[model samples]
Target: MAIPRVKHFEITLTDEGVAIIAFNRPAHRNALNGEVYKEWDRSLMWAAQSPEVKVTILTGKGKLYMGGHQLASTADIDESKSRKAVKESIVCVQSLLNTLINFPKLLIAAVNGPAIGIGMTTLALCDVVYAVPDAIFLTPFMQFGFCAEGCSSYTFPSRIIPPDNFISDVVAIATKTTNFPPIAIFQTKNLVRARERETLMAVNRNECEVLLER
Candidate 1:
């Protein structure tokens, strides 16, 4: 059967308890944009709530996985709205990261291509990540003149290292993870990451405030 495809992403039902959310913006190299986020939010909710979904494999169409924030034309910032705009934007990213981190099911990221800025951070949120040999991972926050989102401030310090083998390894572990009882998996995730919540919260707030100033 042909797999189901969403306008902004693809959802492929695997053997029981696993799904793949593949980004669909080949032309833009799957850059993160408002519309993509809207769809992503809904898709994520579906995967999280659906009874049969216990694992989500996140990847992108074409070679590149995610190109980070979409490039936008520069606009003269009105003093009145600049802070509001920055805060609102940062809020969206923060909320998404929070959702991903707290999601009950396991998430595996496949970096088929370069993962820049928010893309790199998003990978860190995944329970497992598989990267192609040529994949480049970078956080370009300094160049973008904004603080990092997706809590890379903390995630990178720990998760983004060791550079595991490719998609095959991810598949192996994902398959194993799906076999565990959901309650045990969820509780273990909580127990392991519980201490990081406080740090993550502080960083989220600090990053937003700094973004407004930048």
Candidate 2:
């Protein structure tokens, strides 16, 4: 299956059935913006429906994995349009979180470098995470006076593997996973995630509501 074309993400499906979604905004440190969010939603949904793709791996294009939300986008909002801009931003974020919470495929994250803010919090949504030795994971919500988003409040305790082979190691694991029966893999993931889906959705709603209030 052909991967969908996206401006902010580079999507590729390997022969081994691993779909790699790279955050391609290197100049912006791979920050998430409205366009990126939309692309991600489309890409993941496409991958979930692609029989050729049995696993999905998310990583960054450059040194930094992801810098989180594009604060500059918010900074650029005109004072006169502040309310509308904030509300749109809240909707965009909540929509992305909803997609992640309901994603049915095996999702993996390869932290190439620093993962800040939403980048750090979203790792909880991945089934597996691999990071380089110097990769920094930080959620500075308190500094920004914002509560946790991305269901991190309920799923914060994540396991991380240090760089032995980085992307290659992650790909190896994904390839192995793909070798299993696809239905079994999908069902197992759904069973494991079923218990927390509701909680994650609730957290996402509450977080977005608070952000909107602020």
| Tens digits of per-residue lDDT for model 2, 79-168 | 757677667877888888888888888899999899999898988888878888789989988887777787777776234666666788
lDDT of 1 by residue, 138-185 (tens): 888878777677777776522242334544455566777788899988
lDDT of each prediction vs. the true structure? 0.73, 0.84
- Alpha carbon lDDT at 210, candidate 1: 71
- Residue 189's lDDT within candidate 1 is 77
List the lowest-lDDT window of 10 residues for candidate 1. 157-166
Q: List the residue pairs that clash in candidate 1.
A: none
- What's the true lDDT of residue 16 in model 2? 89
Tally clashes: model 2.
0
What lDDT is obtained when candidate 1 is compared to the true structure? 0.73
The parts of candidate 2 lying over 4 Å away from their true place are 73-77, 157-165
